[model samples]
Target: MECAGYIDGAFVKGEGARFDVLDPSDESVVAQVTGVSAAQADAAIGAARRAFDSGAWSGLTMKARAAAMTRFGEAMRKRADWLSACAVKEAGCPVSSTVMGAQVHAPLRMTDEIVDLFLRLPEQEANPLPMHERVNPHFAVQSLKRWSPLGVVSAISAYNVPFYTAFWKVVPALMAGDTVILRPNPLTPLSSMIFAEAAVEAGLPPGVMNVIVEPGLAGGLAMTTDPRVDMVSFTGSCAVGASVAAQAAPTLKRLVLELGGKSAQIYLPDAVGRAASAALSVCTSHAGQGCVLGTRVFVPQERKAEVLEGMAALLATVRIGPAGDPATQLGPVISAAQRDRCAHFTRAAVEAGGRVVCGGKRPEGLDQGFYWEPTVLDLPDNSNPAAQEEIFGPVVGVIGYRDLDHAVEMANDSRFGLSGWVHGADRVKALEVGLKIRSGAVNVNGAVMSSYASGGGIKMSGLGRERGIDGLREFQMVTTLTIGG
Candidate 1:
């Protein structure tokens, strides 16, 4: 199939270069995508601007907008199967772990919640202040604060989980009365195309939402640097995120960035016994491509050997194959480039006195696809590159700490603080240790990312929050109105 960029409410073929969307499982051409030129990107941004300024979408009542979003989501749900297949083929996400979870279900669920939350919000609230007799002695004066859309938003998504990430940014921006220009990563543009189709089917205003597919960063850069775009919600690497921030700085664009992480999973003294099983989660969850996965593991010095042994045994048993196999527990990485990157990190770590406990090379008999063995490295200290960097592959480095304080120190020593994990027998102790870790979200025991709260990062992990009430508010600007009669 040939995919075209959706611009100004039309599925327009790009005047720029064309590229093939490869199926990571076998390197087959799943689809050929035609990319938009700079002019096409400008048109997308212009459309969003016109849509926002015209109030074709933003002028609607809150309830009416919510209804529109609900319809959009329903349109998406109807194509769940196709979307899932496209994601598995293009991104190499496992149907068992990712396609069923984040790919198809979770995003739809988040859309419903965002619409509900948007409708529940108060459009305006009364503000109380003490009367200033010197300034204006009007006792009958009334002050009101209102939250409105920030205007045109450019929502850029990452390839790992493209659809959900884009949906996370787009739905809230729309609910807040903003028109949007969505740019999906070049590697995974299928879902984004479907999103555009759904918007049209849902009867969104002509320029309310737009999608642009490009082989390079030109189109995305246009969306970021363009003055018409009021906000940019980005999800990708830290380096690219920094660039996005810099590009958008001239316009002072509102940004919500979800970037990279070298997060830690700490096993308290008592929890060491349960650590190995839960640690295997990194290997199974889409080959640890997730930014929030705890690739750095901190365990008590006394129990480090036992944890590594159990982890190595479990790693030996993981079934590595293509994403389509129901029996396959571990799928290939997104591409050969990603697999090579993983190998490079593993080799570098080994050169730096790190011992490979189980896997450090490509798996056997799966030479065609980009598959890496579920690797576990026993590191001498937290200073190793494997322990410090974001590999974005199925690799974990285990480091031993002297005590709880030592664990906390090692975990917080990194430059990226996106997320963390804490496990212990004592709930109070686990919660306390979790609170001490300098990350945005911490999972106590087996807790996972929930829909009810906000999640983002601190330090180099990037700025702002995503999901929850705080995320919905990110798309809005506040105004205070003072009236006197």
Candidate 2:
């Protein structure tokens, strides 16, 4: 199949070179994409700029925008199967693991919430400047806070869960009346292309939503540095995200970067027994390409041996095979480069006096694809490369902690503070432990993250939130209008 970039209201076959999209399951060509040139990228940004300035989309009433978003969402639902299938082939995600959850369903549900929040936003609200009043009591002044849409946005998404990341960035920005040009990673561009089709089906005005595909960084650099683009919402690695920030600095564009994470999973004394089984959450799903998966597991020093044993037993039952297999619990990594990167990290850990309890290499029967076994490394300390680096593969590094304090200390020691997990029988203690961890979101005892709450990281993990009211505000600008008396 052939895929083209979507610009303005139509799909265009660019003048740039063609690149092949490979299926990681067997390293076969699933589709070929025509890359967008720098000129085409600038055209996309110009289209969004025109749409925003002309009020073709941004001038609509909140109700009309919400209704259009509803239609767009329904259109996406119609293509869920196609999107899921494309993602499985391009990303090597298992059919049964992330297909229905992150790839298709979750984004739809999130859209509903974003629409509701967008409707609830007050166009203008009264605010009393109490500090100013106290300082100058001679003159009375009344203030009103106004919420308005930021102009054009350049939404760049990662390839791990392509459609979901695009939806998470695009939907909220659109709902807040910001026109967007979505740029998906070239390796997995098929699913994101659906957004353009859905935009047309939903009757959105031209240039309100655009999708661009390119194999190199030039298109992304154009989006980040273009003066017409008002904001940039990006999701990728820390190194690339930093580069993006630096590029956008000269333009002074509003930025929402959801970057890397070396998150930790802490097992309280009472919940040490469950530590082994929890490894499935990281290893089994999409081969741990998820940015927030707790790859560093902190367990009690005394129960280290037991945890490793249980982990080995549980992982042994995981079915690792082709991504299309319904019974596959774990799939291949994104590509050959990713598989080799995982191996390099594991080897570094071993060289630093660590031992591999299981799965430091490829599976026995899977030689055709870029498959890496679900690995677990028993590290000598938290300083090991396997424990500290974001491997972006199905590998977990187990580090022994002296106690709860030591565990919290070790968890906060990392520069990346994205997500954390705590397992404990006592709810109060678990909550306390979660509070102490210096991360954005913390889950206790298998509780899932709420869509209503904001999701983002602190420190190096990321700069801004991605969901709920706070996420909506990320796409909006706040102005305080004062009435002088």
Candidate 3:
């Protein structure tokens, strides 16, 4: 199959080299995409600039923009299966989670879920006071806040959740009236391209939203530094994010980074078994490609044996199958490159005097794809190499802690603070422990009180929030208006 880049208004093939997209499940050729030239990339930015400057999209009212997004959502729903399949093929993950993350969860939240939430945004905000009506003063002045779009958004999305980021960044951006230049990961561009097709069918205006495929990271240099680009919203590793920050620095583009994480799961001594079980499930899910999957598990030093035993037993029962297998509990890693990365993480843990409790190698008899056995390590300390790093694979590490304070201290010690969780008694103690950890979101027990909350990281994890009302504001800038009556 052929994949084309969407620029200005239409899909076109550029006069550049082509690269193959592989199905990670079997290393088969799924589709091939042409590399977008520097000029072609700039053309996309210029097109978005034209759309923004001409007010073709930004001129619409919030309600009108919402309606257009609803239409696009309908169009996207029609292609949901295509996206799910593409993602499963390229991502090498379970079919069910792919369907949920790409087709169902993200699309709904992007359109229907956020419509009323966005509609409730006040046209004018004030630090309300009675002075406006008091004493009949002539020429009374009140300071009010009016929000405006941030013009052009340059979004460089991570490959892990291409379809979700499509909704995460572009939906809020368009609804907030900003034109966008979308640059998805070169390795997994199929699902997002499907979304661009849906947008075209939904009657999105020319240059309103463009999808550009890059052959390599060098192609990203031009996309991030486009002089006309206003803001850069990136989702990837901290190493790459810092480079993006530097690239966007010259233009002083507004930045919103959703970077990597080494999220932790704190198990209070009372909740050791339950917490360890939850941590194991999270770590093993999706082969742990998820940015916020509680990879570092903090268990009490005393209950380490019980926790490790239970975790190992549970891990043994996990059914490993092909990416599309309905009954498969775990699928292959994204690619051979990713699988090697996971291997390196486990090897590093061993070199640092750690031992693998379960699944340290690839499974036997699964030879076609990039599959690795889910491994849990008994690491030396909180600051060990594997414990502190964001491996982005299905490898969990157990670090022993003394008490609640010790757990919180160990949990908060990571440089990347995307997410963490505490498995303990109801809201009171868990809330206390949750507040102490310096992450964007903290889950208590299994309730996920802040699951739908605004999520972004502190420290090296990221810069801006993605969900909730905070996400709506990320694509906007505030303007203070003062008028005298």
Candidate 4:
């Protein structure tokens, strides 16, 4: 079926060209998704602005707004099956990974399990600050602080975790009472289209939420640079994110960017084989297309052989095949280009004196799809490009550290600092080492990116937070008022 863009209140045939959405498992054509012209993206931005300005949505009472959000959550839950199918086929997310990851923490399916959490989220701070005491009897002064919605938000979601990332941007901003224009990554946009269905079913104001799937250079540029946009929330690569921030800077629009990560996992001298197993399992999850996947592993130099053996064993057990299969734990990367990326980085690292411990070649039988075997490389130094850069593939590079101090230093010695993981025998020791590293979320012995707290990074990993109170605040503007008699 031909899938068109959802703008304002209905699905429309875009004036721009159309592109084929492919199934990564075998490079088969799943469906056709049409693109919207730059003018169409601007129209979306205009709709959001008009809705916010008209008070059609922003002026709603908190109770009414919350009720709509709850209905949206319920509607999304009803369409969870379609979400699961799209997640596996088009995006190559592991079916089991969507079906309650047995190896990882929490179900990342973005289904009923997660929507309920969004529905039950605590109310935003309506009046965060109290008014000061009266100054005098006749001349009394009152001060009030109010959190108001940002006029309009432009949300650009990433391809890797399109539904999950896009949901975070949409739901919180909607709950904060801001109108949104969501431009889903052209490569993996079906899920967001489904999300728009939920919004419509929940009876959101016609222009309150809009979704567009178009080439990034045109649609994304138009959305980010338009003057009607009050804020831009983006999730993608650092290079693209930098450009988005620069364009929005001139307009002084608020931005929440969740960019790339070369996050590391430090397994101390007392590191258990379980940690190595966890690292291997994660690299295979979503075909290692995750931004927070610990692609770089740091272990005490003495335990390299042990960790390598454990990783090889764990990876051997992973079933890399069609994402449609429920038993399949590892699926193909998103596209042939992504598959090539995995091969190029691994080949480049191997030529630079890195040792390929296991699984670096493309699968011989599975030549139809973008399938490369899980790769584990042993880096001679911490500065190897593969160890320092974000590969966004199923390739794990292992770097050895001298000691605790050395481990911390090496973990923090990257241009990126989105997330980190440290596994040690002593709880206090692990916490200390985890604390020393530069990251938004640090896990002691697991790789869990939870929605319970704020998540984002320092330095180049992108600015602002996305999943907690900070996330809600990102969509709001604060104002103070004083009255005197």
The predictions' CA RMSDs to the true structure, in order, are 1.6, 1.7, 2.2, 3.1
As a whole number from 0 to 100, the lDDT of residue 95 in candidate 4 is: 78
List, residue by residue over 1-485, the lDDT tens digit for candidate 2.
Answer: 35467788988886676889999999999987778888898899999999999997899998999999999988988987898798789988889995458877788677777888888878899886687672476776778899888999999999899998898889988888999999998889888878898899889999999888888888899999989999999999999999999999998999899999999999999989889976777898789998899999999999999999989998988899999999999999998999999999989999999999999999999988999998999998889988788999999999999989999999998989899999899999999999999998888777464467888888888899988778889998899998776
Q: lDDT of model 2 at residue 277? A: 78
**TM-scores across all candidates?**
0.97, 0.97, 0.95, 0.92
Model 1 CA lDDT for position 441: 82
Worst 10 residues of 2 by lDDT: 128-137
How much is 297 displaced in model 3, in angstroms?
0.8
Winner on lDDT between 2 and 4 is: 2
- Candidate 3's clash total is 0
- Candidate 3 C-alpha lDDT tens digits along 405-439: 98888898889998888887656887889989898
Q: What digit string (tens of lDDT, one per residue) describes model 4 on residues 1-485?
A: 34456677777777787788899998898878667877787777888888899898899866678788778877876766777777877787777774223211222333333344444654433333343465655576766666777889989988887777788888878877899888888788778776678788889998899987775478778778888898999999999999999999889899899999998888877765655675566666788888888888888788888888888888888787898887887788888888888888888888888988888888878978888888889898788878888888889998888888998898889999899988888888898899899898898875554555688987899999987567767888887766678
| Residue pairs in collision within model 4 | none
- Candidate 1: misplaced stretches above 4 Å? 131-139
lDDT of 1 by residue, 190-261 (tens): 888777888898889888889888889888888889898899999999999999999999999999999999
Alpha-carbon deviation at 269 in model 2, angstroms: 0.7
